[model samples]
Target: MSLDYLQLAGTKAKGKRPQFFADSDNERLLSILMAVAGELAVTRERLDTLERLLEAKGLLSQDEIETFTPDSDQAEARGLLQQEYIARILRVVQQEKEALEEQQHCQSNNDLSEIEQELSRI
Candidate 1:
């Protein structure tokens, strides 16, 4: 098994991506979503580089970049990234939540700050 992060979604022998979400509600939509996500990621990186170049050339200011907000489509893309992120990390998040609940029950009725202090001592 190769542990390549970029190929986690898998690909064919000819460098084509395999449809991992074929059984999804709308396979076409899923494929498009994945394509859009990939494109948006690349576009975002390129935009960041462009902004840095502009700033370096004194054409754009740091404040302008810092205060920038995405338009509706970019905002939606961010939402998609957030959803995909939750899907990716849900299991670990659940496990951590369960562990925290267990620790809360096992420990006294102290607040989280007290628990942190106790943990730091350990």
Candidate 2:
């Protein structure tokens, strides 16, 4: 199913390139949120779906499921850390987009490229 966030005027985000969508700051934050959330939600859903399917198909036993806890303490801690990281990023991108919109520039590349850049740097 299409996501609710898909209806938002956000998908215009591309890059700092000369393309029109590339230069839009309007709803860039929204676009980013939608893209990332959609991916994460799909992943979570797929994992859960697969878990159920495996159980039904006898490909995985109950003990296997019990051992494979994505929500375990360590996994949960990491998830929380990642969530905070993304939330902080989106917050910054969102505020920047709003500021740019107020100035009518509405085209600042979301300037949200730092996080991914840093990740790639690592």
Q: Against the true structure, candidate 2 has what lDDT?
A: 0.60
Q: Candidate 2: misplaced stretches above 4 Å? A: 1-26, 59-73, 80-122
**Each candidate: RMSD to true structure?**
18.2, 15.0
lDDT of each: 0.62, 0.60
Tens-digit lDDT string for candidate 1 (1-122): 22342233233235543555646346545655665676679879998899889989999898988898999999987777656544433333344456689898767656766989999999
Best candidate according to lDDT: 1
TM-score versus the correct structure, for each prediction: 0.34, 0.32
In model 1, what is the error at residue 48, expressed in angstroms? 1.1
Model 1, stretches more than 4 Å misplaced? 1-26, 66-122
Model 2, span 1-122: residue lDDT tens: 12333223223344552323555565565556665787688779998898889989989987887876565787877776566546543653655667668766433334446666878999
